[model samples]
Target: MDMTIDAIDARVVPPVALAYTKALTLPHLASAVRPRFLVLQPNGSLNQANSSDFQHGLESILEQATDGVIVDLLWVGSLDAYGIAALVAGIQRATALGKQMLFQALDAKSRLALEIEWAQQQESSVGAWKHTFSSNLEAFLDNFTHG
Candidate 1:
């Protein structure tokens, strides 16, 4: 059965044409063991259809990371529960290893989704939970990596 949907949970965010875009990663800090900035500059909606790809890509890249991933949701025009779950899963992995994670450029709806899901999980907000709304990216990464 083929059906059409009118909108996403993020009604304010205009819908974007789904594209086969992958998250782009770069080494933000050289000396740090953890705090690797895994930027998710995806060019498509992080929805149910692509959650697995997002999660796997994130985890695969994260496996090489030490501290946390810097999820840049600047290009993510749409987000759903599954996407949030994937993000949380990565955060859970980082937390299990006793490290903090950070994300930026997230919309309020998506951010709220994460917060609501986080409240339900009841996990320690140690590694991935500590968030600084605004700061110089370089300085933040430096401060994030050190104790």
Candidate 2:
């Protein structure tokens, strides 16, 4: 059965047409992998204000993707706990739908933020888990190849 990107999820507002229109305004990052791969490079800080856009962009892209999505943090300068949580939620959402959500090329700061937030989540005994967060895109892709 063929599904439109906007039609993939029923809960989100603004539907496919509006979502696609909004997505066009966001950054279109290059994906090292071809076909069904959606790479998003969010610049500057990823906080509450920007995370909605990031999340929406991710959801919109996921609607259209067949394989999975990749969020490259190479250009992200800072990410807060909320931002990390948002990413975790997005990854969970993707995984629930049987798609991969890969986070790649994390900078030192982003890496630290993810570790700190992840540790906090573990300590609290709750929160989403990512099976695929890597230092590089090649490594992220290699998992599928090796498996």
Candidate 3:
């Protein structure tokens, strides 16, 4: 995956700026081939105060994305059960829409929090390893786009 967030020229499209929850700092693939994925970087406290924004971002990004999305959970300051539930429900909605939603839990703390929450949900169902995103773009794409 691309580690750097490409800056966008605001004069071009304002909705691109609005797509991000609080920023317009991702993707410059226009010169290159079409981008098949988008990354969602949600930050700050993810409680009742901002879960609505997060969900709105998720929904809007999914509409903008062509293939899939990787939600980076590293910068989140805090998360509650509601935040966790939003993620789970968002992933299910993505699946229903035939789009992939992969959680990019870069650090141990985020990984543990998401895994614990996911484990609780797994008791009632199961899916493949596509739910998680890896640093290796090749392997992650292989796993996420295929079985």
Candidate 4:
């Protein structure tokens, strides 16, 4: 398994960016070249309309991904309340499906607050998921190489 970090625009939902990144990674996927980790960094202000589209797009992309591929996604930025909710849901769903999800709260205190609230709502169900907080890309790389 290989590893690749997808540093996305902070504002975009992780899923949406995942979809786009997957497209760029199609050749690898088709060849069964499993990547141990995929880090996503959405921009600080991903457009609302794009978020919805990205969710649907990501779902479609996942359908084509190889089973048992461990994906580690990271969201970095200060987002709006609604944006944070969308991101949380996206991450939760990915985790439920066996992806490792991580969130890096840059400087958006309000957005981080909302993320915590949303996480609390799904606490019981999301416990099996792996979550982390950090801005260190090297750490992710280390896991990626080992995996």
Q: Estimate, for each residue in 44-138, the C-alpha lDDT of model 1 and write its tens digit.
A: 58779988777777675566555445666776778889989988887887777665557778888888999988876764543446555556886
> Best candidate, TM-score-wise?
1
Give TM-scores for every candidate, taking all chains together and pairing residue i with residue i.
0.58, 0.54, 0.55, 0.46
**lDDT (Cα, tens digit) per residue for candidate 3, span 20-123:** 42543334344344335666777666677667556755765665566767777777777776677677767767887899888766567655766787777776
Alpha-carbon lDDT of model 2: 0.61
Model 4 residue 135 lDDT score: 55
Q: Clashes in model 2: which pairs? A: 5-63
Error of 3 at 19 (Å): 5.8
Superposition error at 41 for model 2 (Å): 1.3
**Candidate 4 lDDT by residue in tens digits, 63-139:** 44433222232343334555555556666666667754444444557546656866686776656466655757768
In candidate 3, the residue pairs with backbone N, CA or C atoms under 3 Å apart (3 or more residues apart, or in different chains) clash, namely none
C-alpha lDDT of candidate 3 relative to the true structure: 0.61
| Better candidate by TM-score, 1 or 2 | 1
True-vs-predicted CA distance for residue 144, candidate 1, Å: 36
